[model samples]
Target: MKRTTFSLLVVDDDEDDRMIIDDAFLEIGYAGQVKKFMNGKMLFDYLEQIDPSFYPSLIVLDNTLPKMGAEDILTLLKESPAYQSIPVVVYTTSLSPSRQEKLLQKGVYACYQKGEVMEKVIELAKQLRELAESNSPKE
Candidate 1:
């Protein structure tokens, strides 16, 4: 079950990408808090320090992150007892099948290529919302 208000954690270094994600969420009328991190270091720090009960409903991660790459971060998250259940969606410009397979193997919920078109991005956001909602903790 989901909380009354959902929360989202997004890790991306690109300012434009962040804005687009925010806009997409807003456009979809997502009633959630969208936290942004410009680097993997900060994101990791935040994750490690947060109380387990307050973990985000979902994590939207980029394949290429500053400070740490997706593989390392995903590994850490999956290995951690507190964060392994948190769904992670890979949102990146890299559209490699092997890369997607690798992330899927690493336990990512889904992988999506960042879109250049607004409509497509919005659609992705809608899909993400559904994925996150599905994974929400049971109340």
Candidate 2:
């Protein structure tokens, strides 16, 4: 089967983190495209004109951001039927209990500390690629 490149959305305020994620993707030789968004508000606005069928398969979210925090954006995402199918993975430095709890409640598919982000980002890309190629949702 011809593998389709997965589309990943990197929603982070920090430029460096986005670069790291991009590097990780390149390292993995992933057949996936990543769209960078510095803030959720901007991401949301951009999504307005996009077809829901092109919704990203994976969303890498940073815990903290300006203009719009990850939490608020997640809330809005959950409320949108068209955009809710994307699996969100929280990759951030903060692993505080309160933040973790809220993230879990909001249905983050996975959470990883920034220390392990590079490895996890590569893993995430591989897993999503497998899922897409197999035409099945990961269990």
Candidate 3:
């Protein structure tokens, strides 16, 4: 069977981290599209205009954001009937296993702790790609 490419919505405040995520996607040879936002407000504003049916396959968000954090965004998405199905992966530099577990309980698909190493980043990228692809809309 043929596979469909994923569409990812990423929310991060750091330019370098954003670059890393973008580069990771490239390293994994991701075939999907990635849309990035520096803040949650902008992401929400954009999402409001898009059709729910066309929502991205995955959402990769940062724990610390300028306005709304990852938890807030996840809560908002989970509360929305139109967006609840989309998978969310929290990517953060903090190493809080308890927080990660809480996020998982709150409905995020996965939590990945960001690292500086290229190999680790590449591995994370591969995992993200697998997750995004696996959760893509079934034809």
lDDT for every model? 0.85, 0.72, 0.83
**Any runs in candidate 3 off by more than 4 Å, and if so which?**
1-6
Candidate 2 per-residue C-alpha lDDT over 1-139 given as tens digits, one digit per residue, 9 for 90 to 100 = 5434336777888898777777776787762466778998778876786766556667778888886777888888888888777677787887888878879888887776775556776776566455434533344
Pick by lDDT: which candidate is best? 1
Residue 56, model 1: Cα distance from true site in angstroms: 1.3
The parts of candidate 2 lying over 4 Å away from their true place are: 1-6, 116-139
Error of 3 at 43 (Å): 1.5
Candidate 3's TM-score reads 0.88
lDDT of 1 by residue, 21-124 (tens): 88998999983567888877888788778677878888889999866888888999899898888888889998589888999999988889898999999999
The root-mean-square deviation over C-alpha atoms between each candidate and the true structure, in angstroms, is: 3.0, 4.3, 3.6
Could you give candidate 3's per-residue lDDT for residues 84-112 as a string of tens digits? 99899998999488888889999988888
List TM-score per model, in order.
0.89, 0.78, 0.88
Candidate 2 lDDT score at position 46: 67
